[model samples]
Target: MICLVGAGPRGLAVLERLCANHAGENELVIHVVDPFPPGSGRIWREQQSPQLLMNTVSSQVSQFTDESIDCSGPIRPGPSLHGWLQSHDSDADQGRRGPDDYPSRRLYGRYLRWVFDRVVADAPDTVRVVVHRATAVALEDADNGQCVTLDDGNRLAGMDAVVLSLGHSDTELTGKERQLAGFAERHGLRYFPPANPADLDFDKIDAGEAVGVRGLGLAFFDVLALVMEGRGGRFVPSDKGLRYRPSGREPTLYAGAHHGIPDYARGRNQKGVAGKHRPRFLTADAAHRIRENPEATFRRDVWPLLDAEVRTVYYQALVAQRGGSSAASNFLKDYLSEPDDPGTLRRHGLTASDEWSWERLGQPWRPHEFSDHATFNQWLLGHLREDIGHAEVGNVDDPVKAALDVIRDLHKEIRLAIDRSGVIGSSYRDEVIHWFTPLSTLFSAGPPPLRVEQMAALIECGLLQVVGPEPQVRTDPTGACFLIGSATIPGKQIRTTSLIEARIPKPDLKHSANPLLCFLVETGQCRPYHIPDPDGAYESGGLDVTPRPYRLIDAAGVPHSRRFAYGPPTESVFWFLNETIRPGIGSMILEDADAISRAALTC
Candidate 1:
């Protein structure tokens, strides 16, 4: 018997591969365990409100292996999310969703369920799949093989191997977060720690209450939708753009982050599902050469190549927009010969204003200081409007968006240069993890363009306000409320009794709140991955595992022969852990799953 823990997308991928590689001679019993439904698991469970939508378009997501995935196992072609919706008439309302439209999370959950059912129905006769609706709280070595204990007090014994595909999990609060929580509890205020937004109770916040939100990433967008639209407020088209119609049930929200701006809206999907930007500078061969150097750092080596890739795409689009295809070709030829020369661009009729830099784009607010909140707010609003305009122009047509989208497209090459000892230890900790990861995420992983449009409308209607850059949140004991201020805007602060942390907790194995993870650590079944730097070691807060099959490394530095782990839980071991499988791209998730399945079966 083989046991699969956490039946989310990662676990589902393993099951698909197990069947695909099955020899069909011996009987195979697979036990799938999770408290939530098998396919959707916790976060993507069908119970979420329909207002919460997926960040990816429907045509891009898939649950099955396809021709694009390079794996040793046999490919099992299946429908993409859009294709599945087209066939399922019962989902007529959602079935009519266009390829480019974002589907509700609940609808995606339904699709996951259908995919799970389909995988089971098509499994070979030799394979028998049993799903348990209970969490696997503990695992231990048994006399025969291994044993998994469920939350329901049942035990599945004599398992040949087990795979832990635990996705996003909650972690204990940090020192600052705990202090804030204590303050809120003492004063009868509401403090929401980092969490899945769908699980938060937004209704508990009183109407017209002043609420301070402490993150401006994707989670903040979800909170905005829930507290506004979910509370009966509506957004309608106006002469200028969108106008908010208040239901008087919305909270006055002040949201901000280090950058003091919402994430950039995703560029419009002019490229189809299979469309991709071919990298010229940041190619795999280039990355491999960088990996050969012992002194390589992301800033010193990788960023130059990545920057060139972005500039190449940006100027290609910009020149094409101005002087058409033939001009773009000539510009590319000259630009390739002298990538750093400004003369090449000027020769193509481009000015200094046309130059692109990732640093300026990533931290646009750095060069100026706002005297007060009003000045910052106006400046921010203009930035949002400009971002929306570029988004509307589409990723393919817009020069800026096309350039920024390179960060998304060249992720595989990026991973090749940074994941698992690709760079020096100090460089990995400081340059790659601390600096580059967040910057890339902010630039590439943003909400739908429509969401940003609604955000601008909310700000115009006075329902939402953004605190200035590098915001600091503190407990104002004198006022018995939370105070949020920005270092950039001195003497300006917003006070509120309700404070919501609109972000997910970073994965920390040492302080994981989940009983299963805690048990694993306490029992020495696993340990947290640590990154060594010249100064000191940085705790990665990810489960340490072997490279290929990803066997969980024990506390004593030994890989467990019969155990494996992947997905978000093994994030530091693998770069870019949170993305779903795209149909026509080579998927790391699928590759990892196939390797683990083959290893598990052989064991």
Candidate 2:
């Protein structure tokens, strides 16, 4: 018997494998636990907001290891994206592509839940599944097996092994964190902690409010999307690009991340983006150059090489047609389309006359013709009829968002390293890990962790009015909510009363400040697959577990087994989420069920 914690995707995957991969008619009882039932979907996919899009494409999101195994699709044999979509919608057969690229994250969540249910239904008679609608608070060991403690009074007494599937955790607050809020208790502050945004009661919020958003990143974008698109109208990314209409009265968002002003760049080369999954641009020349330069940091040694390659790949397709008369016409159109002011002609502004174009370059197929914000905007409006509204969009991507993307991509690179069994603690490994580790809790931590700088910026701007510097106090926008001292970033650790059980970060090695930091400002549309990430924290090998709400404790007290755990409150632990489902547990249930079936086997 085993216990699996957290009913998220990873937990469910383990459970499915347990049942399907088992050979003999061995009896095993699997315990699945979570406040939400097995199918409620994890934080990332389970969404109340339709506007929130997935980071990965649907074609890339199946549970199977093989890309060809497309069970997540609408049909079994429909491994290719087109086949599956056409099967689901007969009308899709007429089109080359139909809403298949980056489908909704909300839809993907539903798909995961359905898969979980199917695995349970098809389980062998030798197996029994149990689900606990509770959080696993603690892990204890006793006697021959392990003890799994649920938040409620109940407990699971024994288990052989626990495979942890805990998801990302929240990043916490640090120094001078809550002072701004505490100081402005009499006034107001807008501290929107990362929680279930839909669960919030928006009516309580006043209209025509001026708010200062702490981070100018995707989370900030989520905030904006929620306010604009979620408030009323639907959000859709179309041929026209990101479009948003009136969502009641939009708030005046005052966003201030570390990079106060975002730096914009000319659109990068698009040749790589044309490839299926975006090709890696690790050239021999660049590698040699990097290896040769003694003082080479990635910025000095590799960026220029990558930049040139990306541009080459991007413009290569257009070489033939670029010399045509339309090129001049397009250039004229680009100039004529812009507003009189040069500042208004920038890429970040949603309305900027930029674009994504396609033309039959004298060679094979349709090659891209234009690649700038103005051209992209024009293409979308003319062809797709979509437009993303930005009151004052930055020059390039919001710098903080770009930084996070770098960190996120760095994690992918690290995964590649792990897959190759690459050794760590080397210059490269250390460089990469530094970017990813900080994001673990954000990827999993409940009641999301805010950075110290995020906290400081709010306080400095008087957006979050401060009270007690050490022991903080603050007031919410509508004056309906008030908070005690929460820490600020850099030293976002503070101890006070009210709301969450706030704890300060310890000055241990785990929380030591990383000095080798690079504020990578831009990752143009043409970023290479190999650049090191700035936001990635640490890369460890033990178990690539998420920063889950539950804890993973080794069952030292279980006398029979060497390393076993009762497991986290696995969402689908009952069937087979932790080390494959077995058909035995609470011995009597297995004995009786097996005995009845075995005797009937004679018939």
| Model 2 regions more than 4 Å off | 44-47, 67-101, 180-188, 194-204, 233-249, 258-312, 315-414, 418-603
- lDDT tens per residue, model 2, 390-441: 1012112222222222322232232223321222223334432332232322
CA lDDT for candidate 2: 0.36
Candidate 2 at 298: error in angstroms? Answer: 6.5
Separately for all candidates shown, the number of backbone clashes (residues 3 or more apart, or on different chains) is 0, 91
Q: Give each model's whole-structure lDDT.
A: 0.88, 0.36
* Candidate with the greatest TM-score versus the true structure: 1
Model 1: number of clashes?
0
- The sequence of per-residue lDDT tens digits that candidate 1 reaches over residues 1-603 is 999999999999999899899995899999999999988888889988777888899998888888888899999999988998888865433533789888888888888899899889999999999999998889999899899999999999999999999999999999999999999988999999999999888888999999999899999999998999999999999889999999999999988888778888899999899788998888999889998986678899999989888889999999999999999999999999998899999999999888886667877877778778877777788889999999999999999999888899888999998777677778877787788888887888999988999989998899998887788898896848999878777665888989999998878899898889999999998998876555666667789998898998999999999899999987776677889888888888898899999999999
Angstrom error at residue 86, model 1:
1.1
